[model samples]
Target: MSQAKVDNYKKSKANRQKIMKREKIMHRLEMVCIALVCVVFVGWIGYSVYAKIDRAQGTAQETVEFDASAVQNYVSGLTQD
Candidate 1:
């Protein structure tokens, strides 16, 4: 082959190799980003489930209105009994 043609072929080969290398690096970065996003999503879901369970545990706590007289009467009844 001619010198110019050989030189061109070698240059093209180098360019192709560079492109492939860059593509591989980009692909690896994409995979890492995807994995990180999945991990964060799972963590958020777990937190949400835990929060719901915690809130549910408090559902049975009854709140009594403040009744000073009733409280005093109960205290007196307890003392007499």
Candidate 2:
């Protein structure tokens, strides 16, 4: 082959290598981004479930308790008029 043709072939090969390297880097970045998004999604779901459970626990704690003196005082005040 002529010198000019050989030079052109080497240049093209180098360009192909650079393009392949860039593609690999971009693919890794894409995977990392996907993984990050999945992690955030899982964390949000976990937080939502925990929040619901916490609210239910709070509701369960608010049980009614008997208070006799308060009721008697209220009744006496109403009767005074």
Candidate 3:
């Protein structure tokens, strides 16, 4: 091999442990970040579904009665002036 290639290989070998340790730490950090994102996504979907169910169950269905004679009396009173 060339002299320069041999020297480069020796230098990389000397720091191989340090490089491997750094790579391991980076891989673990990446996995933790991915897990955190998945948890937040699942939580958001759960909250949305819970809110929709709550809204549906909390509303009361009622019938409103309209008074036409009351409205006609009010209009007539306004027109009296």
Clash counts for the predictions, in order: 0, 0, 0
How high is each candidate's TM-score?
A: 0.57, 0.60, 0.71
Q: Candidate order by lDDT, highest to lowest?
A: 3, 2, 1
The sequence of per-residue lDDT tens digits that candidate 1 reaches over residues 1-81 is 999999999998979978899999999999999999999999999999999998998897788888699889999999999
lDDT of 3 by residue, 1-81 (tens): 999999999999999999999999999999999999999999999999999998887796567998799899999999998
Model 1 is weakest, by summed lDDT over 10 consecutive residues, at: 58-67
Which 10 consecutive positions of candidate 3 have the poorest summed lDDT? 54-63
Off by over 4 Å in 1: 1-11, 61-81
Q: Which prediction has more favorable lDDT, 1 or 2?
A: 2
Ranking by TM-score: 3, 2, 1
What lDDT, from 0 to 1, does candidate 1 have?
0.95
The parts of candidate 3 lying over 4 Å away from their true place are 61-81
**Residue 49 deviation, candidate 3, in Å?**
0.5
Q: How much does each candidate deviate from the true structure in C-alpha RMSD? A: 6.4, 6.3, 7.2
Q: What lDDT tens digits, residue by residue, belong to model 2 across residues 1-81? A: 999999999998979988899999999999999999999999999999999999999888967879799889999999998
Higher TM-score: candidate 1 or 3? 3
Instruction: Name the top TM-score candidate.
Output: 3
